[model samples]
Target: MLLRLPTSVSETQEYLTQGAVPIGGATLVWATWQRDGFPEHAMSLRDLPEANTIEPETLGAAVVLNRIDDRVPEVLRRAASTVGTGAVRRTATVGGNIVGSTLRCLLPAALVLDARAVILEPEGVTETDLAEVVAKRQLLLSLRWNTPITSNYVKAAAEPGGPSPLVVAAALHAVAGGGTLLRVAVRSEDEVFSETAAYHGDAGETLSTLWDGSLGRLPVPARELVGRQVTELLARPGGR
Candidate 1:
């Protein structure tokens, strides 16, 4: 397959005029080709300068997405690294994680961190709150956040060979009041994709539930674990 790459969207469109196919991530490109037809020609944004850097003003010195590896914060980098196997990581952009319009485990930490999404559409660049973007499907260009918080990721998948998330959660400490923020995102594929939130005084039990739920061993609902229900249950000592 021939690849007609561009550093700018304008350049990509130019190639399209020349009968080239357009793509962002190669995986998406390949998927489109397999599901549809040979792109005739393909355009990729890999050469763009915008895809490389992460700005701190946006996210309280959040780590750059490309550099999101073991060297970065454990929770954030682990989320990035664990997105898929090694090959997928090598080519997949951070924006791809959020744009798929599915519930993801990594993004909740950013929501808790008060992150914003930096989108560069054909119109121009615009920023929107993460929550707003999650409410619908929009092509995303970049992601931004504004907090320095401890974060964690949890997931529950089926058996030994499934791609679906039975349940997933990402927890973050809030920057404002030193409180804990818990974001639980779930995807039942054709069923639903939703995010629920709660504040935690002590996140230990919530974390336990998230960790276990990701592994399909959860006994508590995400709302209860992150909400007041856990506290009420604990108050009774031997309560469910």
Candidate 2:
């Protein structure tokens, strides 16, 4: 396989347009490669300055997980902190996390933020909801979101050296006309079990409508734990 590390977005797009894949962190790459095999050509975005930018409205695709700090948002910080051990956190990239299906710790938090992604492809740059990016496993350039008001996150225990924990994350935001909107997500290891709630008056209404009784499908232990977490999270100041 040929590996091309491009330093500019234009160069990167050129390579991708020619059918080269983008690789970041290489954590998921190595594993998937061992199982499947390598692409004919791959491009590393490490040298692209745009891939490392971190700001309030944007998180670069190659931004290190460990670099996410308190300034971003509590829910995201909490999720990033617990993605894996220190080594994994330092090595993992936001694009890798979003693009690869292996790890999903950040998905719940990102969903609750109502994030959008800027994507680059053989065609050109396009912007869309983050959910679409994850679904299609597209090349993500950056993630963007409005700053949230109040947010909370909870997760199940992770085994040592394990993948992401089961996460239930929520955040509140204000809409026009002085009203509050809430976003909520439930992510298991393999799939996102619940659709993100887009602030339905209060937690109860949101939960009832969004969950649509799907909580009953989880194993007893998970159901109970997630149940407690949902209760506590909504009961806090944000839900009302």
Candidate 3:
């Protein structure tokens, strides 16, 4: 396998145009390579300092998951912590988690936070919603979003600290009309439900509906447990 380390964004883009798979932390790529065989060419983003910085409202694509857990909002920090253990978080990049698989713990938090991805294209750099970027399979440069007033993330898995069957993230913010704006996103292996709504005071019912819709197909007992977890998260004072 041929590996090319690019120090600049333009160089990375050039290598990508030549069909080199972009490698950040390589946690997912390496796993896939073990089964599918390594690709003919790969571009490493580790040397690109520009893609490794974590700012208040932006996270570079190459930033490690550990850094995100340390520096981002509570909801994202919780999600990042759930990605894997310390060893895995040390090697997993934010970009890798975002683009690697739909089951990533961070994606639901990102969705509820309304994060946008900065993409580096052959033509130029562009900013777009995370969902749009995922749909188009664009090359991500960074992620940007404003912090919400309160946010929480929860994951329900089959085993302790195992991969989750359901992940939920919710954020609450003050709206212009003296109401609270609640954004919730739920993700499972087969479906994703992301919605934002305004509520006068309490948002319990709306949140319950969203949770039911997202996990309705699961077994009754499993769905009930998820519902209880969501309720506990929403009931926490100061959004925990």
Candidate 4:
């Protein structure tokens, strides 16, 4: 029932492709029948203890987690709730989503926050922007960064799974002491898997738009919507 494969998501993908139903982080499919008709081959992410943490040195931006209870940001933790169901979030790993490209709720926030991932390849350990890593094929060992901006996440769920609000958006600004540096990221599953960014020089407009969009009623382009939402966040009167 217990089988510990290589820690890499790609290697694990191979097993899944061969009809191995994964029971580890980010995936908890229950297979009625295995490829070889075995009861189960429980894959363990815990076996690879090295793949842990969001890497605090990368601070204020990188919020990685193996379980939903780990030290990730509140926005990200709330984002995880938008995934499939409680069972899925319970087993899903942020690293698995980053490397495997499954549930992507956390990515827009990470990308908007300028988060990067630290990967462990056969060659060696290296760092890459999270967007690029998601674009390419690589084994994500850990994600490292800091989340240093007041931000918001927006997504609209439809009634009975309708067509609107397959959209998601995120906004982030640098921390105080010249926090005008802003990054707004948007994603629409209805559209292609492209993450668009809007880097506005003024934090005021950025925060304003971000808050408005996150709490807004319309489905706007990820870029423009994120901009509006972020603008609102920054424009708030009390040093928001």
Give a tens-digit lDDT track for model 4, residues 149-222. Answer: 55566675656565435444444445556534555555565332323233355655444554455323324454
Among residues 3 or more apart in sequence or in different chains, the pairs in candidate 1 whose N, CA or C atoms overlap within 3 Å are 21-41, 21-42, 59-145, 155-214, 156-214
Between candidates 2 and 4, the one scoring higher on TM-score is: 2
lDDT digits (tens) for residues 92-142 of candidate 1: 566555555243545644554456776554555578876666566444555
Off by over 4 Å in 1: 1-4, 8-22, 40-42, 55-67, 70-73, 101-105, 131-137, 160-163, 175-240
State the TM-score for model 1: 0.62
The residue-level lDDT of candidate 2 at 93 comes to 86
lDDT of 3 by residue, 88-184 (tens): 8999887888876656667878887888898888887788889887777677888888877778877776676454567777777666656666777
Off by over 4 Å in 3: 160-164, 176-178, 208-240
Provide the RMSD of all predictions against the true structure, rounded to 1 decimal. 7.3, 2.9, 3.0, 6.5
| Candidate with better TM-score, 3 vs 4 | 3
Alpha carbon lDDT at 215, candidate 2: 53
How close to the true structure is residue 122 of candidate 1, measured as C-alpha lDDT?
A: 52
lDDT of each: 0.49, 0.76, 0.74, 0.52
Ranking by TM-score: 2, 3, 4, 1
Top-scoring candidate (lDDT): 2
